[model samples]
Target: MLRSVLAVALLCWGADGAVTCRNENDEPVNWYILYKAPHLTSQALTGLEYVYIDSNVMRKMAPSTDNYKDIKHPNGVLANTLRPLLTPIRSMPNNFGFISYSDQPPGCNAMDTFGHSKGVVMVDNSGPGVWLLHSTPQFPFRRDQNHFWPESGARNAQIFICVTLGYSQFSHIGMHLQYIGAFPFEHDIPLDFHQELRDAVNWVKSPPPNNLRKLISTDVNQPFYSIAKQQSEQPKVGDLYVTIAQLLDSDLQVQTWGCQRDRKPSYCVSGIHKVLNIKDIHTVLGNWQPKHDHSKWCVAENPNNHWTCIADVNRATTQYQRRGGALCFQNQRIKRIFLQVAQGTDDCSTLNIMDTIDCEPDPHTPSLMG
Candidate 1:
């Protein structure tokens, strides 16, 4: 069955074009964004309900819906993304590899120690791997499981963003993923996929840094109790650099951080700048997921800002005490599109992105008390 699937996929590839994910119809796509309708109400679709936004295939951005109103049918997009992997090694291209990373990976990944990051990555020698960031836990099962995302993941709202580029760009992605301690499907990664990360780390740490512009949002998922005690300093995560064409000020990146609703646990927290208080409707997506979920993402509240970012962390009473972050961008088309879905914001914050830099003196914190 797998062999036949690969045969059909090989026949489908344009060969002349770049390697990317397919759309709802299994057609070639340049760049695509998927929003999995959350299982909020009992009527919502179950098991990875996908709302696809493929720029190449579907240019018009639609409102964030809870079902297959966007696509004629809901053919698991992630499943199609992993299809080509099953193709025989000999028939494989030397330039590409796929890694399915998640908090709930194929095995007991023991990822509890890491951040609250979950997603899939596929890189090719041709360019940087496409990182599909999402909220699903155990998903995109192993070959033995028939290469599919399980229904167990359909209980909540989820989001997946896939970006493809050259090897140089992926090196930057590697640096960010490393910050969160994300690995390619754990030790189960194949040899072809190994070089992607090895090369990325070596390249990023090399003398001439790529310094590529991209967003690296994530949730560290550290407990407030541990932070209150002297057990560990705050998570030392990296800040993403923004170089959008319309946004002139370097300070814009600082404002995007404002969207984070929680206060910074310590100075070692992610990003060197401050977090902003974003009330813009764009970021205020209407219960964007099953229960106002997929905490990390960026969005442009107004045209004056000309920037948008969707993150995976929330600053609500419960989540503010947790850990997470998001990536931002100045791309007009993307910014405008996401703005349309600006339904509502799950949580809100009064602290500016910059203000969150310093840790609030808390009696629970041993250092603060001492």
Candidate 2:
């Protein structure tokens, strides 16, 4: 089984030396989630299929499975939790630290205004760390390109969660990547760590007075929560799943990038809290649509509100006028595995009597309306 999960993750390396989040049987984990599955039909599409869960199989709730895995399986679990930042920075450990943002970064050219976000944080200056929020776009490929995974992220469906916090939760994940203006093509953050990780590696030339920020994970006593937003040209009082359904008071369903362009529809608006929008997913490696999933997430439609986010914008209206955030938590087994892969949505009485709803495009996605 992938070489016995890389021989029990190399016999649980450095036992308590920190830096974790490895499970796919590779052990160590305080959190984990990964979905990946997309590339629907081109025959044997090698988009490195996936599906995994952790925190000890969500404390034994586990069951969902299509039996996938292959994210460059050299003892997978994303290559054994990115083999110590793809090794060789002089054999590492001068109290390491890292960052790796992305707005489609890899070889570069796609940062428009930044903050569509993607992550990788690392850290370990004597305390622990791992944070890996994601939605993939030219991913994990620039630690001198020692490569970890990415072939243009194998066409669509993506999602990742990671989390293992510590070193003072990376200064609230470097001020939530400087309130999401995140575009650090690569980073190292060392000068004795936290200056909000050198202001999130120079948030695209400085800019974090906050368009939104929220924190709460108290350095991994764990209950995680983080929000971040910024990418404005105007339009920001609410959007980001209506401020995550009024800050987790519940009611949300979301899932994003469903054939972009203007999108937004399904926020039932009456007294707040109700974000809907999903529209067929049914996973276990099967059903699709939503133009072949580009995975942004949400969940917490009551059932005693066990929240669960994992975002990077895309309810679209030009992504709520741009920029993004999300990384909530309050797991009820990760909110029933993202509420059983949703199934359908877009209600609100069909958008309160329709005024335009067409969607269904994906001729291999491109035109987000100029």
Candidate 3:
């Protein structure tokens, strides 16, 4: 399938004067943005964080992006999928960041015959990985960046989902699956945005399903945890040069994409391709996935940022799958872990395993010395 798509991409080459570009099956294509710089920055990080925690921001930019018409409602689907995730973040009082897209509304005119002839889309080498946002408003794509978001007492925190796309000829699917990074962002206390960002990126870039899941599940047994925990515990948000220097030492690379390769600034016809550290930036930009959810961790440095914590958490989740399962999980090296909790019945009351509650005494000293 990818071979066929590549053939089409070859034909669509801007040099060929193909006018309009399409997949092998000839479906109208949309430009997809897979990675953004700094991996975690003020605009990409704080902007989305503010929107997610604030209802006003959520209303204006929850799924912020330019809406296109030709694609029949791409924005709607994309925005809806992300709305739930952003709402909580926007509601936070201190969060901040911005939202934007590479493609304009009604999809872009690949023929280079309409508004912004510079608009274009690109798919990953794999095959429909995931769909984060569409280029159009009906289903626009947006980003969040909160490098210093504070969480005094919070649960059910936000998780980041990074995806890669591949085009298909049979279904005329213009995107394929390459990689998925599912990273949960939480702090031990006194939140450190930079550290969480580093952990999230490294977790996504780590290697596969087990590694990625282990990052979010807080599974101690996972191989990447030692490094992730260590870095996450370190300092973030300090002197710019100092932070950048520290990031480079860890293996993050800074790259620029979405421009011309001909020694000129040209719009990326196949989207953008660059690398950077996973920690430096806030937003998790990239292509969206469709049906499959494949997540894992690999030891690769992202040229889009400057730090090296590339863990992924893509397990192809259906709307149904996300709703089920225990909310809190931890990874343990032990093969089996047993716990004692209360079970539930008619009215609901207890700390049994079935009940899903804990009756253990609070470890902290009495608040009022009771």
Candidate 4:
């Protein structure tokens, strides 16, 4: 039944109509998540290999053969979904619009003041679009460049969450991006579209004075919550994970760039909610420490809450002074996948880990400060 619906939707779109997130097989999907593994062993991994999960996988509640693919492959999920924007065309339709933003843009120096966000938002005037939130820097290069992925992105682990939303949701997304201080390297929002998108593009030039912004998006069948925080001069109110843990009213297990200098220790001071840092991850490829992973995400500790978020910032002290955000949702399967990978945490004594296996340090990997 799911295949039939997707096939019908594909037929309706007719290959070149509305922009949507495509699955591994290039089929249109409502949403998808990809976890690109880092180059753990020089002999086996390329760091471009990733595990994929989409609306179909969620429906089945089971892993599939197509769950794993190469990010550099032309027929892979990343290439399949981004072909419309990256490939050159004689003339673009009037209804199509897009925005590519990143703090570390290709052919440019990384911006410290802008949001640490990176993603592409593509929408059609007819009322459907896709929002791709990711952790890879300098990715999906400017449309004019005709390059989809960057070589530098393959060196570290990354996470990407893409959702297909209706046109009405773009305004809310725009507002969230504005709050995060997103730096749009390339964009084209038609005048006929919502005014907030134009404002988002303009916000990059003249940022607002707001420290944080939050919004709930229900334009689609599912509900998505977004939270954005700007670079604060003081650490008075800039711990993104802590704020999210409090907002959801649940303890969290977070993963981020652990090798960064001045990395903050796991937060257990909040009596109501504790944010523990994930130190080791167990994926299909193999087990690895946080030193080899650069993905940023968090999952609710309690199974009942079922909250999962893919974020753009790290748990490092320097990151607190930078703009960033996260897109969150409540999903049982998604939450489970994130939870299972958390084999060990900074405060392992607080949680039960009798069944967890510690990953041995790789001899080939260079030592880095954590």
Candidate 5:
């Protein structure tokens, strides 16, 4: 019943044609997650494959594709990077705002200190649009220029997750940016004039909030949290986490369980099956077809527990010093993908490992320290 309702909503929403995400082929997608595999994959074309997943059920884990349909301009994300900007003011929902920020914002230098989070936020005045988060640096290109991926960023595997949501939920997102101290870049899109938007923008410039927060992105069915290093309470929500090593926050005194944020093992996650990419690196991505790729994600080994998440930072070193975060959910299809592709860890030499009955530590993570 719920699935049917969501399907109907998606159809109506897609038909509106107010916004469309350009995929690898420059084809419009209701939403899509593209994983630009790094060179470590086991296949020949091996390191490169794009995973396209959208709101439409038929497109679920469609196929492994590297061939792009557009080159004259950036497709996937770069092409439709400024959908909100294109909206006719008269056609905008009662309230609509698409806000974008980057340390390396177009027409400006990258802000040295800012949230490590990178993505697009487009919500109707009443609240309906997708938040596109990705690991690509110097991307989304310039709003006016043709979108193109930087050669520097192309070598590493990158991931993108586009989740669409209704309006009310953005208030929580506003609160998150407040906690992360994410400021609106010089090129930032003006947020809604409403109080909630004001609060988010103000929080970017003000002092810290009282404590940590756990909020859910209802549209995507994923829950996200932020733990400020300055706060007294420790990072603890008790769920498995995942991200890449380069983006880890290393400035803090991060605890080591068994799964280390970086490869050092000095920062370990004691018992849980800290998913690794050490083995065959080949798994069923879609149609259960064998595909090799470099995408960071997590899944509870216990199937019934069903905790699957796709993220950017690895629990590696120096991440504590930087602001970082990840969001997870209990969805069945998302769970299967992460779980099937999960790689188990091998014994490490650098970090000290103490055996304990418990492996899964209370959910604690170091995130954007605004």
Candidate 6:
């Protein structure tokens, strides 16, 4: 049964014509440049917040990518050029409030300290959360090499996300990076991407406490900790525990879409299907509402089943006069990149990138390139 109870709005949600949110017009909220959540009206729905940095600023600090132009592999293979491109990273560049380390393999590995898989370097700075950096043999044919971020310099194409537990800035709930898939490498970014990142960051920083209480606010009053524990304990593949150390990879595209809303807020869980040591509740998006019916969404686990929550993906949407990476493509033509933290949902439609791109698997092609 759907329960109607008082709750917070942790995600930037939109109603038919309006939305209630915090920081609607605050100057601090103006710090970001992507999308903006409508100012929240209820104090209970104010735990959402987030931020996106310029990855290009960080790219500039790294040795010039052009230096690898003359670089060649031992076998004189064109792919060998990928090595020189990475050689500049022998020492990680410092930019922003983050300190990065480029351990590019073969040396004392500090990145593997977190029980990560072999060959995979961990990107952990004195920031929000630890990220997995896997340099596939696809580019540079090397192992044991990893890069750490430094504090200082510009935030080029890579933006790091810092998630918090409450209003307190001291507590870090989680952290992730929203790598600008197109910008610095190509030199342009969509205005909407910047706006979306800006808006997302704001929501993440000041999340609605209701998101936390929603799952735990029941007859049993079970907290998120318990729910997560229950999900983790259900059953998992041993290989998945080691996937974080494996090369970065993705599954093939499947087409589907739909929308749904429940009187009670719902959640969407993300996980690895084994063979990789990377696993966790990536994000918990909240307070979703869609114009279409819930029947438009589909689930990865159950194709016939409907989906209510939308995974934070590489969106190719655009907003006129907006400035940022997401807006580069006027019609939303970005690759499926990083995942956004999940939020609670009232209604939502699950749209897949393949459906729009016609299931063409190619990261090299950038339609909304920067």
Tens digits of per-residue lDDT for model 2, 1-370: 6544543453334444456777655667777788777776743444567666776655432323445347766566766676667765555555676887877766554555667778888887676678888877767864432366766577667888887766876886787777677888877777888898887787633343433344433234447777765444333333687777776777888887666656667877678777888887776556665656677888988888788889887776665555668888786777887788887677777652222244444433334431
Please state every model's RMSD to the true fold in angstroms.
10.5, 18.3, 23.9, 6.9, 10.5, 22.3
C-alpha lDDT of all candidate models, in order: 0.42, 0.68, 0.20, 0.71, 0.43, 0.18
Task: Give the TM-score of each candidate.
Answer: 0.59, 0.32, 0.18, 0.83, 0.62, 0.19
lDDT string, candidate 1, 1-370, tens digits? 6645654556444333345666555555545777655444544444334555665655654444453333213344555555555444555454555555554564444233444456666666554345666655555555321445554445444566665455555555555555444534532233554444664323222221222244322211210000010112322222221211112222221112222334232121133323332333222223432123333454444455556554443323323222233444455676666656544332323322334234343221112101
lDDT of 4 by residue, 191-225 (tens): 88877788888864334333333332323455777
Which candidate would rank higher by TM-score, 3 or 5?
5
Instruction: Tell me the TM-score of model 4.
Output: 0.83
Candidate 1: clashing residue pairs, number: 39
Q: Which regions of candidate 3 are displaced past 4 Å? A: 1-77, 80-126, 131-163, 166-229, 236-245, 248-370
Q: Report the Cα lDDT for candidate 4.
A: 0.71
Ranking by TM-score: 4, 5, 1, 2, 6, 3
For model 6, what is the C-alpha lDDT against the true structure? 0.18
Clashes of 2: 0
User: Candidate 4's error at 159, in angstroms?
Assistant: 0.4
Which segments of model 1 are wrong by more than 4 Å?
1-18, 42-48, 57-59, 62-76, 86-95, 107-109, 126-129, 144-147, 186-196, 199-292, 312-326, 344-370
lDDT by residue (tens digit), candidate 5, 1-370: 6544543443333334444454544345445566555433344333334555554443255546444432224333445534454433333343446666443444444343554455566665443555666655455554443434444344344567765555666676666555444545522233544455566545353333434355544434455443332221111221113221211321111111223323233224544234333332333332111112223454454545555445433343333434434444456676565444444333334333322222223212111211
TM-score quality measure for candidate 3? 0.18
RMSD of model 3 against the true structure: 23.9
Clashes of 3: 117
Indicate the residue-level lDDT of 333 in model 5: 73
lDDT of 2 at 156: 68
